[model samples]
Structure formats: structure tokens, C-alpha cells
Target: MRHTEREPDYIIKNDNALINLENSVKSLCKHVMLRQENEHLKDLVIDRNKYETILGNSTPVMKVLRLIQKVEKSNIMVLVTGQSGTGKELVAKSIHYNSPRARKPFVTVNMGAIPEDLIESELFGHEKGAFTDARDRRIGKFEEANEGTIFLDEIGEMDLMLQTKLLRVLQEKEVTRIGSNKSIKLDVRVIAATNKNLAQEVKEGKFREDLFYRLQGFLIHLPPLFERGDDVVLLSKSFLTDFCKENRMGNITLSKEAVKFLMDYKWPGNVRELKAVIERAAIMSENLTIQPEDLIFANG
Candidate 1:
């Protein structure tokens, strides 16, 4: 007796069969929105071409640009170690803008600004009834920067308890609200900066070593303004050009002596201090040139 059971032919040669195959293929392709692989975890990379246009071209600044370029495409966590007024935030912004996440939110949370009692709620957020004052659901910085970058300024100042929670988030890529048991997934690129010596803090038992290592995937230590050589002068010029235009002061140029004064003095506040000096001088000097005396410092 002949067997009647049979298997269906997988090959399609008829018009209806061909049309069905094409439609299936098209449907699959539509679902696969392939994104080009990021060579470095860095979604954003710095554009050196705009370096001079934005900041300046001194050796120190160039070195900063190189570091930015090197880490621009990498997704590794960045720890910007620098002194106050050293433009740490600026570097953080540069990294974010240059990376692929440039289009996403670049949120900055000043650890020092937030009250110690409320820092937890501000950072990790809380659900209603989490605490006495938490009357409604709150979204924290990590949640706000879910798919973008979060620049945590003064990370060293974060409380020990909060640091533990932050460490958990870094490890699991998820966050739990104050009162919620559910964990929310995160894709944030954390860029933390501090003026403190984290190594020292770790040794002192203040900062968590594990968390430090996690955030220190890539480190960028900014040199002080005085050590940056002629970057002071370069920054001065850029500041002068912008300030004059900003205040409509009829464009003023820094005299040779003025440049010398700025170079010789110690900028304790770094670039921010230098910019303030330039602005004061530009406003004081009515002539086309800014003289040395136009810069008024107690010691200098």
C-alpha cells in the first residue's frame, strides 16, 4: 500500500508564493532598525575642529581636546578630576555633545547644592508615601537621564548611604525608588567630577572603592590654570572678544602689559577667575586697548 502522508514543499515559485515571501521579508526588515555600532561606548565625541571656536588652542587646551577625542566614542564611565573653577563641567558638556547622545538630555546635579536630607529623593526619587513629605511620585536624576548623560558634580560629597544605592544602580543598570519595589532600567552615561582626591577619600574610608572604580572607567584630570602655560592669555583673548561684543563696548584689545599682568598673576579660581578679570577690565577701559591697571586685584 502506498503512503498518503506528505510534507509541504518549502520552495516557492508561483506568483502568490513569491508575493507572500517578499511581504514577509519586508515586514522583518521594517522591525530591524539597525543602528551603526558605536566604536567606543561613547555616544558623543568631541569635535576638535570647534575647539578653537569654542575654547582656545593652548597646549593644555589641546591636550584636553585630545583626551576628549580619545574618549568621545567610548561608553565607559568618565571621572573628571579637577579643581574648582577648572571648567570640569565644561569638559563634561563637551564629552556629551561630541558623543552620539548629544541629542538627549545632558542633566547636571550639583551634589553640594542639594540638601543632605533631600539628596536621596533628588537623586533616586521616591514614590508617594515613601516618606512623610513625599506626597506625590517623584522622578530622580538617574530616571530623568535614562537614555542620556548624567553629570554628577561633586560626587565625592554624596552621602555614604546614597553612594551605596548609586553603586547598586551602576552595577545593575537599574534604579529602585524610595518606596517602590520595582526596579527601573537605565541607559545613562554617568560622568562624575569632583575637586576632592577620591583616592584619598577611598583610603580614608569615606568613598567606596568599588564605586570609584566603576565611575573611573575613563579618567580626565584637568590641570590647574597656572600650570596650563599660555592658555590664560588665549582664554583672555577669547573672553575679551566675547565680552566686548556682549556689552557693546566697541571692541577692545588687550595691551601687551595687560597680557603680562594676567600671565604673572595666580588664578586661584582658574578660568572662571580669569574671565571675570577680563570682563571687569573691558568695562573699565573706555579706549580701544585694555591696560594692566584695568585689572584690579588686591595682591596683584
Candidate 2:
């Protein structure tokens, strides 16, 4: 049978939700194209290696880069753990794109955003007339990502019931659709990410212990932005320079005070927050330079 990909359930459920996911993906890889006019901002920040966009030179970041290289050569499941906004998904994509499966689909399933009821159907396809809304046979994310990679973002948020089924797939390398007796085999690399402490969740009887172990067979923990040393300043420079070019505001450099302003304050929201602040500062500051006063935090 010829394979087909229908519009995903999440896309059909909410347009804004889909847009937000798209934006997050772009934010990691294509930071330059926030607006139609800023298309030239593409590749403005990082090196020509493109998807090697996990920008930083801190010891912590270097360790992450090393770990990514180590696991990319093998088909081991990787669990990326970190605080929110730490770019865990970007790390996962980097591993996938660098691995042998680079040419295959890199399907992403945000287990956190999808409603509990629809998540199962979203992960595992449903047969036509399987349920009231099962109007036609559907191919889920796993099937779509066969011979590639499937990123289960916010995997810790998945309900307990589905976790058992997911564990079985991880062990047996096959998935049985919601209303089918046949088991469809998959050759997909599973990369899961979450901001929550899954070990604590397991201790509290929330997450499946076995599944947690399975996912973390190869773990990559991203250090918080504050712990990443001068990376804050590096990201600040890249963000400011790119935003100025994108907006045609010219080459606005960050002042010494502004550099201190970025480095001294703790970035609780990590790189994502830093990028937002830099972009805002670029617009709020003078055309020539970004001053300390131009920088503003969401809390401030």
C-alpha cells in the first residue's frame, strides 16, 4: 500500500497551536525569519553548518556537543532533560539531522499540548469508524516517522495509560494502531524531551519507572542559561546583530553596559528569553548601539 500523511490531528484541532509549534521550530533553526521582510536574516547568526545551531562555547555546552556526536552514530534513544525554554527540542533535531537518518522525516509530537483524549490517536493511528471522529484511517506520527526520527516533546506529560503502550513499542519495535490487531513495525529513533523532573515524577507515582529508564538510556541534560557562563553575551551579540540587519536598522553593536546588563542578570527563561530581549533591545535602542537602558525583561 502507498503511504500517505493526512493533516495531523493537532493541525486540525487548533490553528494557533500549530503556528506556535512551527514558530518554535523556526526559532531554533531559522531565528532570522520572524517576519516576511526579514527573510534575509536566514543564516545570519550561526556558522554555515546550519543545524549545528546549539550556540555556545561553555564547558557545559561543549559536553552536550560531545554527547550528541557520540549518540548520533548509534540508534540509541535519547532523553533531553532541562528547564523550560532551554532549547531541548533543538538539541534533539541536531542529533537527528546529523545522524544516518538525516534524509528521513523528523516528525515531532508535542505530548504536552495535545489534549489527553486525542494524544493516543495522534501517536497511534485509528482505523476508519474506530471511534465517532475516526472518519477515515489515519497514519500517526510514528508511522510517518518510520525510517527516521520521532521527537516526543514533553514526553513526561503523557498520561500513564498511554505510557504502557509506548513502553511496549520501545521494547518490541512495533506499534499496534488503536483499532487494529496488526502490529506495524517501525525503524524510528525515539528522542524524548521534558522540562519536568521525570525521576521525581516516577518517585511520586506519576511516570512509569521502566519507561523513564528506557528513555534515559542515553540522556543529555542542558545546563540553564545562567550556568552557561559568557554564552549569554555571545547569544546577545548574535541576536542584536541579526535583528538589526533584519529590520534594516543597520549594524547596532551592544555597549559595554549592555553586555553587563545581559551577563549580570539571571536568565531564568534561558536562550529563548535572551533572544526576545535582544530583539526588543535592538528596536528600542538607537540605530548605532544597544545600551543597558534598551534592555528590558518580562518581569522588569
10 residues in a row with least lDDT, candidate 2 = 40-49
| Candidate achieving the largest TM-score | 2
The parts of candidate 1 lying over 4 Å away from their true place are 1-54, 298-300
Clashes of 2: 0
Tens digit of per-residue lDDT, candidate 1, span 1-300 = 123232223333366698998999887776553333342322334343224243656676788778888987777799998888888888888887778787677899999899998988888899999999999999999999987889999999987888998898888999888999999999999999999999999999999999988877888988888888887888998899889888888879989999898888888888888888889898888678999989976456
What's the CA error at residue 37 for candidate 1, in Å?
29
- What's the lDDT of the predicted structure labeled candidate 2? 0.86
> Which candidate ranks first by lDDT, i.e. highest?
2
Model 2 regions more than 4 Å off: 1-52
